[model samples]
Target chain A: MGIQNKYYGWRWGEEDPIFKNLGYIQNVLGYIDPADKSFTSNNFKELFYPGDFDLLQKSWKKYKKGTDHAFEMSYRFKHKDGSWRWIKESGLANVFNTSNNPIGGIGTIQEVTDKKKKYTQLKSILKNVSIIILRLRQDSNNQITVDHISKEALKYWNIPCETLLKDEGYLRNLAHKDDLVGIRSALSNSFAKMEFFECRWRVVSKEGNINWCQGVGTPLKDKDGTCFLDIVITDITKEKLYTEQLKVSEEKYHSLFQHSPQPSWVYDLETLAFLNVNSAAISKYGYSKDEFMGMTLADIRPECELENLEIQVQKTRENYLNFFDGYFKHINKQGEILTVHLYSSPITYNGQKCRQIIAIDISEKMKYLKFIENQNKSLKRIGWMQSHELRAPLVRLMGLINLLTDQDSIGKEERHYINTEIINSANEMDIMTKNIAQIINDAQLKEKMNDVQIIAG
Target chain B: MTYRLLQVDDDPVILFLHNKLFSKYTNSKIEQFKNGRLALDYILIDNGPDISYLLLLDINMPVMNGWEFMDEICNHGLENSTSVIILTSSADCTDLDKSKSFANIVHFIQKPLTKEKIEKLPLLMEYLALQD
Candidate 1:
């Protein structure tokens, strides 16, 4: 013991000599020196913190009015070692005066230096803790009272430290307005079940910024068997914000991929498995959405083209994350071979790496191209025939025409020979001209027949 | 040894002009046929390349075309026996390419064969000198 004795008893108020000596004042209040009786209530009250002594006085006054209670409180007092130590004064005031009024308080004082030091250290640690800790209780009237709150509560609750020991209304206001009903219900449930209660909600700070917090409360009981809710609060704002952003981005991508006009599908690159297909792809491929889901890319290809499709599939192993364009001969549900053009790119869908493909129906374009090529080939053939067939007869006609123009030196036999040759060459030129016309008409008819065959085939 | 000009064409007028033109210019045996088949028949019998022979052939004829005529001459091992000239109105490049494929076809000339074109032919010049 730091003092001569470890404990003492004393009484004051209601009487003849207010300065009566009580033995061992050093032990009674850790005073180190004898207590001076001349001090007023104001001088003695100076030893306590603001409003802390008032609670002890209220309990003492209540005990003096014939109530069965005591002034039991912990307050700071000066120790003999010139340091402040906590003292617990616990005793009832006796109503032993002749006037039936109280004769002041009778109590034993204990120097709670070690207990107070430990409690203060725990409180200091709780204040600096990352997560907020709270002990709350409900009274008989069902009014909730916060029994204790650590300094950490002010980090997100936005309440002042001084007001935390006095009022709890600021903490209630810190809760988001929309989440009050849920929190009240959970609190009642937790109290009734005497189990852990957990929930997450947004809290609005004094600066009007909202932060998400998760609270977990466990049931606890004080010395008087009164139940209190002991809760731990954690700021979960980062996780909550990440989840919200993920949902928003997923919605954006879904709208972009679904509403595109081109026929589109996505497949897993490793397995060639269809992961997703849009409406345009379903209609263009002549398959229902379910049918597409069940089939691979190889299913729609013609049987004869399987070998080529396999080669292309194997090549996909090396080439990744590139824009690829190709023309494929595809067979639809109607067994019609259509020329399809594809544009593909790499993407990640639902955590699966895949390639997205956009297909275009180029059957009509190919048909028109083939028609033009056929017409061009025939046109070249007709031009060749016209030059060769007509030039031969034209050359002979020109030569014969030169002979016919010479009539002055010509005899009768020479004139007949010239006339016969001229007539023969002229008739040949007429036949050759007719042959050129027939050749062009034949080429046109042949082209038309081929066009009809293509449509039928 | 004799040097001869074999003018094989389907047109009688072309053959007559060819025979008359060479006869007016030089003393050479000029044989005209209506087709390549008759010309080939004459070459197999009497006319051979013991002399410097010049064969002026047309591509499109009645019995045997110029290409078939060259094929037959090659089969008979007579491709080296005569120097041939292709005279035709066919302006197709494939025919020119086909004509060059034959060893006997030394020149390809287009129709309306002029005196200058005939004089310009090395085969004709050789045959004319042989005649002298």
Candidate 2:
């Protein structure tokens, strides 16, 4: 898309909704009066910062000469509300379309106040930038001698500017001993290679504080054919400290992602492409890193589980706080299906909207639950045998005992037969009791197997 | 177009079976190799771009296995013109899924091919008709 099409997609008029609400107006450049229809550079200057206006003039000249395609600059501008607003202004000179002569320039102005606010806060630190500019001369012995120092050196090092003017070795002595070798080698290499030199080193101040400093230098020769280095030194202690802290925090975050017990990954919200995956995720899903990159989240899902995934994705988009924890079937590279429960959270990964998920494989848990259900059925069967089987045998023994009599009038043969039957009934009862006891013992052994404890390190 | 059948397998039995079976079809030449490296050299460099051959690839070999050979042929821009049908004993579904990534792979089949199984392949039938 061309720049003009992007910026001018909406025709500027009072009828346009955005322009009507924001009270946007456009004018031609170099016109004398604000009320005139023709644009004026003077009025444009009123809406821009001095640095931005200078950039516009330079870029505009280059565009007119066909050396540059477009001119773009962003800076603080006075808004309709009488407040300073940061805005970007872009221009393209001579937009050719069947024209013999050069056409007038076209441009766009947009409000970037929100993004500029962050830069403004940081800009406060640079209000009085104490950059110490210096010039150095190199002798034939490959020795560097400081020739001049800017007046700002006094404010930073607390030594008079003339002290550097008199003593050439004063600057080298101020640098920390540990940082000297690296800094000197970098400077010499840049000189020999005819490349720009930049390095950071620590400098010991007069107040006994060590400050991080950066030097950016360029090598040049004067009219007398003598080599010199023009360099800029800046105190960057706060920036260095902030960078170190940020690196440590990022390292801790990455380690946790890698060492977590569950398989985890981060995927783009729109495309569902995996942006990052942990080692556990790679091994569990049975895919190499390259294969994962080429696949979407849908590829791992079983066909039956895709509907639920679609619904969950919609709910997440509606509100990232609307979390989901549900079991879904996933297919591995080998076509073996696994059940997993995902704990997902919306995250911004590398500035793109994405989701981070910790997937817990629940296949083994499902198997364990099924095993317990089967065990319950066996226990019910054992209970039935203990209650019904013992009851029937006891009733038969009672009936047989009732038929025998204690009176002396009974026949001797009848009494002998009754005694024989009583012995037989007693033996049958003994066998049934032993069988019930054996069943109970077997049940106890099965229960003991469940006592095995699992420990994870 | 006349077709050439190139079989790469470490097992001597399978290689002999592939050569004996494929050579039965008229107007087609069958070449067998014990490993992927020799087949790759024949296809890409030895014959260059002038001659195109159908491949019977095996997953495991002594050197430069089938996967590495597939990667090489694709990188050399010979994948589109060449036809590959993996004939291996492995029934791994992972290999079937991975074959979709290559441009030339037409079929993934189990090994110990019989006369009936060979006739069932549509690509093989088309090539058989186009022989000479």
Candidate 3:
């Protein structure tokens, strides 16, 4: 075993009695040589040992001359139990005397097994915490750095934590190009105000896919007012897309409502007033928006038609039917009576009874019916003339020709002349009948032609 | 003795042809009235021969048409006892339908009276005889 001597408050010879009383030191197997008076009794034996004696001597000689030379060494020592025990030996060299420069040193040796065990336990705890804790640091130049990050962060980024921490530009490069400027500005503003900021932006992951991230950041400012941002990011792409889709759907419904060609209206069932009316309904009914809003079905229809309209409303309320069509007299803004064909259906508006109606005018159809009646009257007159007056004259002409041809018992020359006269009169009667027939035919043809034109028109 | 037959029509040619044809064909005196009003007056006043005389009626005549004259005679109940036939060149269904409304309308014949159609006139005589 090695021993170290340390000097205390007394001179070296004055401590000789104390050293002599220590039998463990006097019975030592090793002795010091006087030729090298620089050597100490404790260090001499350690230096003469075979393994590290030269190194120890060289170190002692090199440091012995310093005004303050205190040294400590730990090594294995042989114990009485025939086993090696770890020990620490410490000594302070005496450098108080100027003339008698070489004195003894005093030291103590102790075992440290319990302290080593505690230190190992503390080191294990530190390693565990290092794997879970994350710390970020930034310089005064706004260069961000990550000190310690959990392994989970490395897996999530699909890159080594060291790579990400070493280069601040690597994290900036992940930000979407379009959002980089705004994100940087927001971060700067947040730090300047020493406030928290939250924003959503696109980022490129290590896998090269664009991801939407909602980042909430707080400024960590130092006493000098310099700040760094610590941000937490969460994925919110699906929710953002759903919100955009909802907006598009609302716009589509609005377009359909505004631009549909059919005249459509929603009416309040209780008040019988129009709740909503499209442009087509306004133009068709010749009513302003205010006028239509104030009027009810009974006000628009004739008094006699109100009962039928009420029945339709009752049926709609009962849910007996969804659609119906009927004819009603409509008065325009000018008070002109119009025959209108109406189609109505039940609908719900804001959880209230409502109906939609479409109307068409049919006044021209009634006019055509009256015109047809007149045409029938004229045709009857023509038929009466053909059957009665024209037949009478033709009947007489046929009788006359029959009589003239039936004549007998007359002189040949006189018969010839009379027969010639009779034949001439008969031919003239035939020509007259033919002209009358032609006139009737022409009148009938004209009537038919007029009828065709009316139908085509 | 010949029975006098009065023919009324607005057309002059139709009137002349009627006078000549009836005079040569039948042993009856035929008189021509150009308008329905004149014919109605003559038939009302004359009532000639005390043997019913046939009144050939033309529907489209000036002053008084056939329908008006017939209506007048009917209102007076004169058409019920007189022998009358509606002679016209119209083949309209409306005129035919109107003929049914008048009891005095004995027969309806078309215009341009041919010999074959005239030969069938004995059917009118047969109807008159049946009435007698």
The model with the greatest DockQ is 1
Stretches of candidate 1 off by over 4 Å are: A1-249, A268-273, A306-325, A387-390, A399-457, B1-132
lDDT of 3 by residue, A159-187 (tens): 33456556665446446778877876776
What does the lDDT read for residue B61 in candidate 3?
Answer: 84
lDDT, residue A309, model 2: 76
lDDT of 2 by residue, A152-223 (tens): 454655533456666765656547878888888887887777688898988876676888888898898778
Give the chain B TM-score for each candidate.
0.87, 0.85, 0.80
Estimate how well candidate 1 is docked, as a DockQ score.
0.28
* Docking level for model 3: incorrect
Give one digit per residue, the lDDT tens place, for model 2 in B16-116: 34544565564565678889899988876555445557888987677898899999887878876689998765545677888888879988877656556
* TM-score of every model versus the real structure: 0.54, 0.42, 0.36
Tell me the deviation in Å of residue A79 in model 1: 20
**lDDT digits (tens) for residues A1-457 of candidate 1:** 4543233334444421112222333354544344545334446556555676677667555555654545566666554355676656566555446865555555565557687889888777766655777777877666667777777556645644466556756355547888888887888898878889898877877788888888897877667767888888877888898989988987887777787787789988887878888887777778888888888888778988888877876677578767778998878777878788988888888788789988888887787787678778767867776667777777676655654554564568867766787788788778877876776687678778867977885
